[model samples]
Target: MKPSILTISACGIFTTGIAFAGEQHLTCPARLEPDAIQPNHLPAGWELHMLRPVYLTEGGMLHGPPEESAFLVPDNSTSRKAGKQTREMQHWSFDVPHGYTMWVYCGYGGGGATLKLFQQVTESATECTLSSQSTNGRTKEVLEFSCK
Candidate 1:
């Protein structure tokens, strides 16, 4: 029957598995300056070393053909001191063709620098929020932003 044939065809397609195109990764940093500090801004001392967007696939983030970018930040606030440093990790993510450039500084956090992690939104961005953690504690900053 046609129904039986259709079921067979569907099964065949599913067995083939999906083929993904490709992906990319880029690590960026954000070095904060005195003037850069504002309400809800990145913590003090932490610096961003990489900032980039990347195209992803089924298996995972690809590295070639239709690739993009990714970012990495340094842990400048490893100390438990208050004014010593900003103990935490900061991450930013979005889609909808977002774009941003940076300006690093010379100052470092109270302790030292560590690395942070983040996730991204695809296709479109709405009510985006970059998360941040301090002194290895719970998230402290929720940066509300809009993607262009």
Candidate 2:
């Protein structure tokens, strides 16, 4: 059975209807960023796969196919790994507008990886600020904002 989507308004997080299957079913983009993968020093057979962007309204409703929806997919890459304790490093470039919620699902292939969202500095990749709050599902992360 397909999982149902439930949003927790107080926190802007989604919970699946499945008894204890804590994540939303989403796929990681198949395209790989060679430059990102090559430098990661990942194990053989592991590579950086991008996370596809899913947009939603602040009320947790699915948003649109914006004018340039194609660009939404594969904005950045994350390495495939086997444990949730570690998340491979990669620079992400997607931004959630001031009034929407965005969810990015990263399937590390073996089902284990912690997900977090960071705000990239305007000019430096290494300089970033962790979001004040974030919600992590089994293989996904979400960021939300209130409409002004």
Show pairs that collide, candidate 2.
none
lDDT of 1 at 35: 37
The candidate scoring highest on lDDT is 2
Q: What is the Å distance of residue 134 in model 1 from its true position?
A: 2.6
What's the lDDT for candidate 1?
0.24
| Residue range with the least summed lDDT across 10 consecutive positions in model 1 | 1-10
Position 111, candidate 1: lDDT? 28
Candidate 2 lDDT over residue span 4-114, tens digit each? 343323233344422223222222232223222222455898865545432221111122222222213322434444444323332234445554433333222332322
For residue 59, model 1's alpha carbon misses the true position, in angstroms, by: 22
When summed lDDT is taken over every stretch of 10 residues in candidate 2, the lowest stretch is 124-133
The candidate that achieves the highest TM-score relative to the unseen native structure: 1
Candidate 2 residue 33 C-alpha distance from true site, Å? 32
- Model 1 quality (TM-score): 0.20
- Distance from true position, residue 39, model 2, in Å? 45
